[model samples]
Target: MSLKYRDEREPIYTCDRVVHSETIQALEKDMQGVKISMQNRGLNVDVNKLSALIDGVRLDKDKIRDSLYENLHLKGKVNLNSARDIALILSSQLGVKLRKSRTGRYIANRRALTDFNNPVTQEISQYRNLERLLSTLKGLYTATDKKQGKVSCIYTDDCPSGRLYTRDYNLQGIPELGRTVIYADEGCTFILADYDSFELRIISALSHDKYFKDCWAKGLDMHKKAVSDMKGIPYELVTDKERKLGKMLGFGLSYGQEAAGLARNLRTSIHQAEKLIKAYKSNIPEIEAFKQETIEKARSTGFAETYFGRRRFLPDIISPNIVARKKSERQAVNTRIQGTAADIVKFSLVALHKAGFKIDTMLHDGILVTVPEGEVEDSIERIKVIMETELEGLKLIVSCKTGKWWSDCYAKPGRESSPK
Candidate 1:
């Protein structure tokens, strides 16, 4: 059937913006500072080194020498004094001036003139090196099928919110899921375990962030073991397409995805996609009605409620921009569903743990619990009850399954390939 749609394609972005070093230098270089010379033509860097440089503004001389001696491929030797000169030059070019303190201590521009500095700028600079660090670690991967023995359930899907652009067109896909499967270069990545095991892996990846250092400190050792033991089996991380679909299915359902959006995300013309969305809405009248009611209620009352009294400000509903007004309407629709789902997961986890099951994996919509075979059914019953009691809208479609092996009992959207 013909579709009543204007544009169904995802927005494309130009990631290849040529950022000249000169421009960056213009913005960041500070002169009248401690001079650092880049005498070394070849420089070697790892995640640790890059992180330290960003965080401490200094690199360990012993660590650099050890890296050079230990790893031939990753290590490229450059004169240490030259490297310091280079750093000083780069620092000056970036507008980061250095000054001497009364105590003979050296400081950056922020410390010299004012103690206050832009947190966002500092954050961005740190992240720049951190991104490079992640890239370096990608090469260290070695794959095995040890995780396959665990054999539990497998779930695979995509992130709907991530947008990707090809040469001629723009498309939407789930990039985060794919990140795990392939190196940053988009190669295949695999873990030999079940869904729960894989879910924990994703959580570990999240802990890699410096701000999440607490999670890293507590979970890093355990996480590294999990990664190492899984046997790099070359599993595909959820692709941009699939992630986009999952987002389309998951988030769209919450925010009341209309025909046009549904079709676009589904990669079909609007006519086909909208029909499915309409059928879904029709099956859940309250959810659809809630969308309109929320607009009115929020406009009049100035707030929206969550399952557990979680409130999100909705002042944007009265925005002057019609686009923003529409966007707020969508936010109200999705937030109600997603927020309630989050609460249900939390409630289920608490009840399951109280009931003596070891909860292993937690998603926005689902929870994974490890229990003895004798108590599997009982655990499932408790989880369902807690989720139902704590959540609203249509009842959840919970399918309880058990496994003797991890790979045999993973929980994923699809049965074939597990979602990363």
Candidate 2:
């Protein structure tokens, strides 16, 4: 708990003991190189296709708006943009169960609607999704350079975690809708490689939880495996609904989700949520210990450090306010886990760019790069090798998919969205 370092040989995130100041500096420099490469080449997008997609989304949005009016039986009577109206309709009129804020008034935000199973709520979510999708992409058409047929974005270190954010068209937050507009050059293709179940693997790596590691070694779907373990059945027998609850259960606890939050996410009773969390923790007991130790360290140091020494200083870790202090505790856990995730991705990008790949943007856990049509097979292997980084005893897995368009992550043209 001492503030002084023991000659900087401490292993904070991973067992490799590589979280040093100089190592972090070198990686940041390499990330700059990759960013420059991305800016120089820009993103190749088909403006015409993007325009058509926007039209389609716009039409859908209009239909959803009308559908909302018809469903609520308040055609042209309520304002879609008004939270007050939506709250009244959902809470007072329809008597739908709604969550309230700390102030204890009925709310109509996304979190309030998370467990609302009404058709109107689903339509509302769809409408909002389309709205958000269009807002991010509609600006791209205007920002693109017509002569170059590409759009460039400025990267910044503005997020809490050290992940890079793209601006001036906000390429960093491209939603699923934006993927359909990606256009490659005539003789080139796009290669996308992402880490598989990256956060869970990182958790197992950090905690060295045996059962979790064993599951990963066998390449079992962790969600289904959890259900299998709980119900004493085979993995294949785990239903989709059970697997989904298992996913919510695992990740929910991993990121410090509480019983109430887990209940809301799973749409189950608080008792059931607690039972699931208890069962999950019984399976992987070490994760809780790791979280406690991580939070204690952050409390002692007043900051959280990622695997590579990226620090997020938390002034509220010791705050007098219980809510802020508890939130800071959660942030302490999340910053290290999620921050390490972002760092590994950047690490992969730095390695691949230095190995002479024409890198594009990073999509959370993956990278999209452009290579010659004939060099895809070779480049995929190279990217995977560089990306499947090694820790002390654990090696990461990288999945690659190539396509003519960014949305297309298929091996063959007619293939569905299945991984190869």
lDDT of 1 by residue, 130-179 (tens): 44443333322111122321111122112112111111101012122211
TM-score for all models, in order of appearance: 0.38, 0.86
What C-alpha lDDT do the candidate models reach, one value each? 0.37, 0.77
Q: How many backbone clashes can be found in candidate 2?
A: 0
Model 2 reaches what TM-score against the true structure? 0.86
The lDDT, on a scale of 0 to 1, for candidate 1 is 0.37
* Candidate 2 segments whose C-alpha is farther than 4 A from its true place: 1-20, 66-78, 88-100, 103-106, 110-125, 410-420
Write down the TM-score for model 1.
Answer: 0.38
